[model samples]
Target: MHLTRTWTPPGAYDLPGSLAVLARGPYDPTFQVHAGSVWRTTRLRSGPATLRLTPAASRVRAEAWGAGAQEVLDGLPALLGEGDAPEEFVPRHRVVAESHRRHPGLRLTRTGRVLESLVPAILEQKITSIEAYRSWRHLVRKFGEPAPGPHPSLHVVPEPRTWVRIPSWEWHRANVDSKRSDAIVRAAGRSSRMEEAAAMALPAALARLQAIPGVGPWTAAEALQRSNGDPDAVTVGDLHLPRTVGYALTGERNTDDAGMLALLEPYRGQRHRAARLLTLTGLHPPRRRPRRQPGDITRL
Candidate 1:
């Protein structure tokens, strides 16, 4: 069975940017950019669906196949950021404002799949994105089901119960240390509540997710950005974001998380949007020295 949907963008729509936000890496098994279209899979309350989204002038064309086709169709608009109002944000920095003016098409998307975002966020705790993405690709390729329809290369993310069942040895094999793997399992144990929290108020949802021992502000914010499109969701505790945001705003490379928050306070409800704009502007604190990128332990 197939389901089709179309969405006209409220402004300039960069389909790749809209979809790239969902993909963890170029090697991510669950999401991929291919042939000028986005191919992805997710498990809905009904079942798993694989979708192909093709970009058109001022419109997005989507087709879904599988048991969850109808649900994916229903969620397509929100996934395309139909619920987001980028205009609501008032940038506090000259760089941010200029980038916002230049990139009117950049919008925060809300997929409302809490577990889908949460699990990967867990894998990312204290690890470099490359390590996290590789871990995600390995685990999903091993445990996830083949996406339905003709796109067998795609994989539907496993249910929370499956995540919980992955053994400690298996996590080690995937190069995911005990801490991050355990966090994912613990969060998966209450998958129903987590998914429900996605629909709750943003603060309430973050609080609910943070109830898990390993889930923290940073992980919760990352999950909310993807699942709820929380514009104010500022990622805390990142190794580079504080410096990046700070340098873009204050020309200071010595800034920390507190400094980043202080600088972002002027934007208050629109901090994430402001930071995103600054990031798009290609402004950065000059590199004094190359920081060591995280190496994959699983290959060692």
Candidate 2:
């Protein structure tokens, strides 16, 4: 079944910038950018679907195919960030204010599919993005079915049961360590409860996610930011975000998570949005050490 919709946002909307966070990497099998439209494949509760979004003047054109096509179209508004209230976010810092002014079209996207975000967030735990992206691409392409759309290369993300059934060796082949793989399997086992978190309050949703072993504040926050379009789901434990937010706000190169939170205290209900704007400023403290290279676990 093919479905289509045209959505006009209440305010400015950045199609590429808003959806950029959902793409794991350039080679992600479930996401793509071709011919001025963004293509994404996902497994909905009803079934798998492929969605293509094209931005036109003052509106976005959305098209979908497969059993979940109607469901995808129904949620198009929320998926494109119609639920986010960016105007209420008052940027306290100059850097944040400038970024907000510069990127008026930027809005947080809410896919409302917890497992879609949770699995990827779990894979990214304590690993280089290169490693995480590589593993996700390998696993999905190897296990997932072809997307039901014109884009032949695009593939839908695997269902929770499929994720749970991936053997140990395949994960190792994808360079995924036992810990992350185990977490994915556990999360998949509880996929129903996890998906329910999408409709819960942010704090409750976060707690629900963290109830799974190996999932923590960072992972929970990362998942909800996309799944719920939570403006205040501040990622508390990241390798570089604290430094980036701190330096951007206070010119402090040594600020930790606590200090970063303090700096963002003014934007209590929109801390994540504030941090996002800060990062968009392209300000980062000078690196004091060599960049961490992606690890090769397949050799292990």
Candidate 3:
């Protein structure tokens, strides 16, 4: 009922960084991070599955359990960024170059599951990550199934049908606003098409996703970054990214989405990769004061 596989990074790979991208938030329900291992429970096409990744001297050892164990094993390489070519990047900024040099092993992961990403991405729209994560955690704990085998403590994300069926009251109780909750329900209803869309070319895939009412450029970009390890999928409409990118690239504290795109034009085919490398450096735009917190819609 369990399977184990091994993968060695092509040259150098940051196992933690690759996995970190999949963790929706620090309090994410589905992805669990431990001292030296990463645990993830997913509802695969085959069935629910759990994966534990442990780093070794030169490679990672992956153990999976459940009906979808083989699927998880097959996708392990892509998830760990086996297909990503980080060495080929040529950064235009000195700080970015330093980050790439420091973490030559950085790689982008591809999950190949759109609905899974879509649900959380919807919950995350226009809200602080903490708020979104809290809602996600509440929903998953209430609906997700227990992880198979000895990993009894972990939980897999609920199936698409379950997502569609979650009552409006439950969503409100989870502190999810009407707009996001409705979008998730609609997306869950069309989860199959979204999964099929993942096999298409990036442009087509995004278009198919955006066909849904609530999916937009930002949500599509975020999903594609995980679903396909899209190198060029730069996230727009982010509250802080433009400033962060602009400040790091040009030392300008004020910038917008258009400005961020303009500044990243030099690395057109690898904008997301560039942005991620910049973030790894822990550089941020200078802040004058703390930003306002997200409103508690559940209270209203």
List the global CA lDDT of all models.
0.87, 0.93, 0.86
C-alpha lDDT (0 to 100) for residue 123 of candidate 2 = 93
Q: What is the C-alpha RMSD of each candidate to the true structure, in Å?
A: 1.4, 0.8, 1.2
Q: Which regions of candidate 3 fall more than 4 Å away from where they truly are? A: none
State TM-scores per candidate.
0.96, 0.99, 0.97
lDDT of 2 by residue, 121-154 (tens): 9999999999899999999989888999789899
Best candidate, TM-score-wise?
2
lDDT of 3 by residue, 52-83 (tens): 99999899999999999999899999899988
Residue 277 lDDT (model 2): 92
In Å, residue 30's CA in model 2 sits off its true spot by: 1.0
Q: Write the per-residue lDDT of candidate 1 for residues 1-300, one digit (tens) a residue.
A: 888888898878877776677999888889988888899899999999998999877789999999999999999988988888887888766888889888888888889899999999999888778888989998998999999887758899988899999988888889998888888999999998899987887789989999998999999998998999878888888888889888887788878999999999998887887777877878778878877687766665
Residue 17, candidate 1: alpha-carbon lDDT: 78
TM-score of 3: 0.97
